[model samples]
Target: MRRILALLLLAALGALAVWLYPLARPLARYGALPKGLDRPLNLLVLGVSPEYSGYHKRAPERFRGLTDTLLLVRLDPGANRVVVVSIPRDVWVNLPGHGWHKINAANPLGGPELSVRAVEALTGVRVDGYVMVSLEALRRAVDALGGVRLCVERPMHYTDRAAGLRIDLEPGCQRLDGAQAEAYLRFRKDALGDIGRIQRQQAFFQALKEQILSPWGLLRLPQAVAQAEPYVRTDLDRETIGRVLGFALKRPALVSLLLPGRFGNGWAVDQALWEEARRVYFEGQEVAPASSLGRVVAVVYGPGEEERAQEAARRLRAMGFRVLFRPVDQTPGRTEVLENGPGLLARDLAEALGVPYRVSGEAVLGADLTLRLGGDGRGL
Candidate 1:
C-alpha cells in the first residue's frame, strides 16, 4: 500500500510539470528578447498551393509552388498581443540569383530559407522561424475543430474545374466545414481581386482565433494539430510552439495589418506607409502622447450607447481631438480603434481608451482614427 501511494504521488507531480511547462518556458527566455521592447516572436507563414492536377493529390517531398499566402506574424508575449501583417503574393521583388519576380516566386525558387531572406530584406524585420503549410492542412485542421463560424459579408460564387475549386456562399453568419472554408479562402474572382481575398483571409483568421481560444477549441486542439501535422513544415520545435500557444490561450489582443502597397506593374510598396508600419507594428514602438492633439477622431457607437458615446466624445474633445459621431447597426463585443492611415493615431486612441487597435483599409468619416464603442466600453 505504501509503494502504490508513492507511485501515485509521483505521477501527479509529473502531470503538473507538463501542464506548467508552456508558461514557464517564456519567462525563462525573457532576457533573450531585444532591449527596450517586449519579446516578440516573429514567424513567417507561407501557404503553399497545390502543384499537382488534383487538389487532393499528395504534396511533393519538397514544397515547390508560388506561395498562395504570405504573412509575418508577431507574437508579443509581454504586450499580450498578436499582430499579423499580410504580404500580397503579387508584390514584385528582385529575388537573389533570380531576376525580378513576384514575391511568391521566392518559395518555389529556393524554399523557405530563401523566402525568409526575401521577407527580411523587404520588411527589415528578423524572422525567428517559418511555418510552411499546405492548403489541405488548413482543411483538415478546420474539420478536426468541427468547424469555424464566420460571417459572409456578401454572396460569393466561383468555380474552377481544372483546380477542383468551387465557392458558393450567401451573405450571413454561418458555420463553415473544411471544404467550404478552403473554397472561401481560395476564391479570388471578385472585383477586388487578390486584395479582396486578403480581406477575407484576415476575417477568417480573426474568426479562427476566436474559435481556437474557445473552451471547446482548446480541448480539441491536440486532435486538430495531429491531423494537420503531416502537411506542415516548420523549423519551430514543439516546446517553442507550446509557449506561443500557451500565450495565445491567455486571450491576448489581436491586431491585423496589410503590407502597405499599391498595384501598378506589380504591387508597388508605399514607402512612407511601410515605414510607419515597420516602426509601430513591427518594431513595437510606443506612440508619443503629444501627437494625439488636433487629430480628427470618429466614434462609431453601438445601438443604445449614445449617452456613453457622447461622454466619450467629450473626453476626446478635451484631449484636443475633433470628434465625429456615427451610429453602428449592431453592438460589438469589445472596444476597438481603427487606424485609417499610416499614422500612429489609432494606437494612441486605443491606448487612451484602454482597448485594442487595428489598421483599417477604409477611412471612417474622413477621420484619422475611428473609435468603435462596444459593450465593454460601458465604463467610458
Candidate 2:
C-alpha cells in the first residue's frame, strides 16, 4: 500500500517535470529524510506480509507471516550506483529477545524496528532509513502500474494450501497480473530454492523498472499516486523521494548481490564471506588492515587463463595473501584487477601483475579482489 503510493507519487512527480515541494510537504513530513543528508545511504526495505483487511485469515500460529522480501538498497550519489543486496529469509541470525533464529523472525517479533536492528547486527552496516510494504501494498502497487512483463525461465508448479499460495506459471515472456507476480516472487520449490527465487526477484525488478519508467507509466502516475496515498507508509518525504527517484531514473550502474552464504544444516553465512560482502557492498572499505595479506580473497582468471591464474595464485600465496583460483564467464581484453572493496589490495596486486585496476560489479563472494588474467598476462 505504501509502496504503491510512493511509486505513484514519485512517478507523477517525475512525469510533471516540476517540483511541487509545497504540495508534497505534508506527505514528506511523515517519513522524511533529515535535511542536507548527502552521503551513501542504506535503506532496509522489507516486503512484509502482515495480515491486512480483506486478506485471507490464517491460523493463529501462522497469522503473522515473516517478511517476504528483505533487500538492502545502497544508494551512493557519489559513485552514481545503486547496490541492491538480497538477504534470504531463512538465513539464521540472533534475535533481540529471542535466541538465534531465522532472520525473517525479526519482523514478526517487533515489526520493522527489530528487523532493522537484526539486519544491522547481521551486516554491521548502519541503516539510514527503512521502508516496510505489506504484501497487499505490493500487489496493489503492481496493479496500479498496469502489470510488469517478465520472461518465465521454466515451468513453475507449486501449491501450499496452508499458506494459500498457488503458483502455476509456464515458460515464456509475458505480462503478469498482481497476483501472479506475487506468486512468482514467492515460489521457492526448485532445486536452488530461495537462491533461485532471489534471482527471479532481481529479474522482476528489472522488468518493474522498465514498466514504471515507461511513458505510459509516467502518464498514469497521478492516478496511481492518488489511489495509493492512503496505504503507503514511509519515513522518507517527498523531497527525498524526488532525489532518489531522480538518481534511479538516470539508470545508474547497479550491483545486484546476495548475502554470500550457503545452506547445510540450515542457512548460514560464513564469517569471511559476510565480512567481504560488507566491505564491498556496504562499508566500501577494507575491514582488515592493508598489511593483512591473508585478507586478500581473490578469483584468478577468465576462460583460457587457467595456467596464468594458477601461476598468479602461486605467487600471491608466496606473498602471504590467500587466493582462490576460479574460471570466469568471459575472458577480458587485458589484465585487470577487479576490486570488491577498497582498491588498496587490488591496486597492489595490479601493480604486481602489471595491470590496471578498476571497481567491479561482478564481485566474487568471499573475495577481497579478483585478478582477471587477460591476454596481457601471457607475459607473466
Candidate 3:
C-alpha cells in the first residue's frame, strides 16, 4: 500500500515512471488518434476570449468564439517527444470559402469540428483532436495553481478601458496567478507586440512544463488538471493522454517551433504577416521543406540585442525572403551596407552564393537593424 501511494505521487508530479505512470494509461488509449496516427499526433489548443452573443448567433457578425490563443502540440510516441508550437490568432490565413481571414475565425464558423477541419485543411498535418478554453476558465485554472512564476526580460504594459484590463510591469521574475496571468495573456499592446506576446506564452508554458515534471508541481496535479477541464474542452481521449505522458517523460527532444520565419513587426499589423503566419503554423508541416520554397535569413545581434535580430530574421524568412544573413557585431570603422561578410568573413559567401546585391545598415538597440542590398554579390 505504501509503495502504491508512492507511485501515485510520482505520477502526479510528472516525475519518472513512478506512482503516476498508470494514471495516463486509460486516457492514452482513448486518445490514440485514428487518422493522423502515421506521424506523431497533433492536438490543437485554442483559447477563446469572453464571448458575446445576440441575434446573430448562427451567422455570427463576428466569431462564435474568438480563438486568439493557438497552440499546436505534437506528440511523438515512437520518439518519446512532445512539441508545442504557438500561433498568433491575429495571423491572416486564406479561408476556404471566405477568401482571406484571421486564423482564429475558423473556430466560430465551424466550432470545434470546423475549426479542426479548417486547421487540418490549412496546415496539411492531421489534427487528431482539439482543446478549447474560455477566458474565465483559463483564468480560474491559473488562479488555482496560485499563479505561476514568470521572468520578464523587459517591462510590458497594456490598457483596455473596454475590457477593463491594464498591465504594467518591470523586468525580472514575477508570479502571476489567475487574474494577473489572464490579463497578461489577453493584452497584446506592448512594445514587444504579438510576436513578443507569443514568446511570453511560450516561455510560460515551457516553465510550467518544467515545474509540472517535478514532484512538487505534480503534487498539485489532480486539482490543477480538474480545474482546467471545466475551462478546457478537448476531443482527445484516454489513450492519447497516456501516450503524451509517456512520451513527455522519455523524449526531451520534443521542441516548440514558433514558425519557420517572421512576418512583421510586433506593432505593425497587416494581413500579409498573417498570411505568412498561416503558412507556417498551419501549412508548414504538411508541405515538405524542399517543396516549400522560401528563404531564411539569420539576423544576429549582440548581448541584450539578439532577440530583435532573431525575430527580424524569422519574419523575413517566413515572408519567403531568401536573404538570410547572420547577425554579427558592427565592424570597427565607418558603417556602410556592403556585400561584405562579418569583418571580411562574408567575402567567401559573397563569392559563393552570388546574388544580385548585398546591403547592410546599423541601428540602435530596441530599434531596427540597418540593411543594404548588393547590386551584384556572391556568397553561400
Candidate 4:
C-alpha cells in the first residue's frame, strides 16, 4: 500500500508540472515576465498577399507579393482599450538602407523585420511584437468561422485577367463565402480608390467582431486558432499570444483610426494632425493632472507662424491633446494660452508648450481648451 501511494504521488506531481509549465517556465528561465506582454503593447500586423495562378493552389515563394495591409495595434489591458491604427500602403516613406519608396515595399525587401523598422522610424513608436498573415491563412480562418455576414453598401465588380482575379459583389446584406469575401476586401478600382476599400475592410472587420464575440464564436476560437496557426507567423511567444486571445474574447470595444496624412503622389504625413491622432487614440490619458479634459483642443495661430503652430500642435497632440489648428485674423506679439474656466488642462497645456496662459475669454467655441500662437512664439 505504501509503494502504490508513492507512485501515485509522483504521477500527480508530473501532471502538475505539465500544467504549470507555460506560465512558470518563462519566469524561471528569464527571471521576469515576457517583455511588454502583460502591460500596454504595440503590435505591428501585416497582411501579405501572394499571387496565384491556379485556382485554390498555393504558389511558390518566388511569387509572393508585397505587404497588402499595415496596422499598428495598441493594447492597453489596464484601461481595457484596444486601438487599431491603419497605415495606408501607398504612403511614401524613406526606407532605412533604401531611398524613398512606398511603405508596402519594406515587407518584400526584408520581410517583417524590415517592415517593423520602417514603420518604427516613420511613426516614432516602438513596436513590441509583430504578426504576419498570408492570404491563404485569412481564407482558411474565415472559412473555419463558417463565413461572415455583412451588408455591402454598393455594387462591386472587377476583373484582372493577368492575375486571374475577379470581384463581383452586389449591394445588399448577405453571407459571404471565403472567396467572395477575399474579393470584397481586394477591390480598389473605384472613385475613392484605396480609401473606399479601406472603408469596406473596416466594415467587414466590425461585422466579424460581432460574429466572433458571440457565444458560438467563442466556442470555435480554439479550432479557428489551430486551423490558422500554420499560415500565420509572429514574433510573439505562445504565452503572450494566449493572453491577447483571452483579452480579445472579452469583447472589449475596439477603436479604429486612420493615420492622419494627405494622399498626393503618395500619402504625406501632416506632422501636427498625425501626432494629435496618436495622442488621443494611441497614448492613453495619464500624463496631465486632469488629462481626460484634453480629449479635444483647438489651436489658433497668427500669420508668419504656420510652421511654429504646426510644431506646437504636434507636441501638444503627442502629449494627449486633441489639438485642432485654426488660424485667426488678429496676431499677437507673444504666445498666449487661454481657457474658459478653472481647469487643470490649461495649466498642463501651458507647461507642455512652455507658454503663459489665462483662465478667461472665449478662445475657440466648442473647444475644451484653446491655444493662440503669437509672432514671437517661443518653444514652438
Best by TM-score: 1
Clashes of each: 0, 8, 46, 0
Looking at model 1, which ten-residue stretch has the lowest summed lDDT? Answer: 29-38
Q: Can you write out model 2's per-residue Cα lDDT over 21-45, one digit (the tens) per residue?
A: 3236334444334343367778998
Error of 2 at 96 (Å): 2.1
Q: Candidate 4 clashing pairs?
A: none
- Write one digit per residue (lDDT tens) for candidate 4, span 1-380: 99999999999999766644443433333222333336788999988878565764547644136886888888877767777777878888888888888988988777788899989988878998998887776676677778788766567899887667789987656788778888988899976576567656766776688777777765564455555666667788767866776676455566555565556787776677567556655565433355543577777765566887788778777777777888654454456676543335777778877888754323454466778776563656
lDDT of 2: 0.69
Supply the TM-score for candidate 4: 0.64
Q: Could you give candidate 3's per-residue lDDT for residues 1-380 as a string of tens digits?
A: 99999989977686644433443543343444333233467888887766534332222222257787777776665545555656666666666666667777887666777667766665556888887877666666666566677655455676665556677765555777777777666555754456656756765665566666666666665456556655566666656655555555553543454533345532223335335434533343332223213422334333344454455455445645444444333311221223111112223223333422222111111212223221122111
**Cα error of candidate 1 at position 272, Å:** 2.0
Model 2: weakest 10-residue lDDT segment is 54-63
**What is the Cα root-mean-square deviation between model 3 and the actual structure?**
11.4
Better of 3 and 4 by TM-score: 4
Candidate 2's TM-score reads: 0.64
User: TM-score per candidate, in order?
Assistant: 0.73, 0.64, 0.58, 0.64
Return the candidate ranking by lDDT, descending.
1, 4, 2, 3
Please give the lDDT score for candidate 4: 0.70
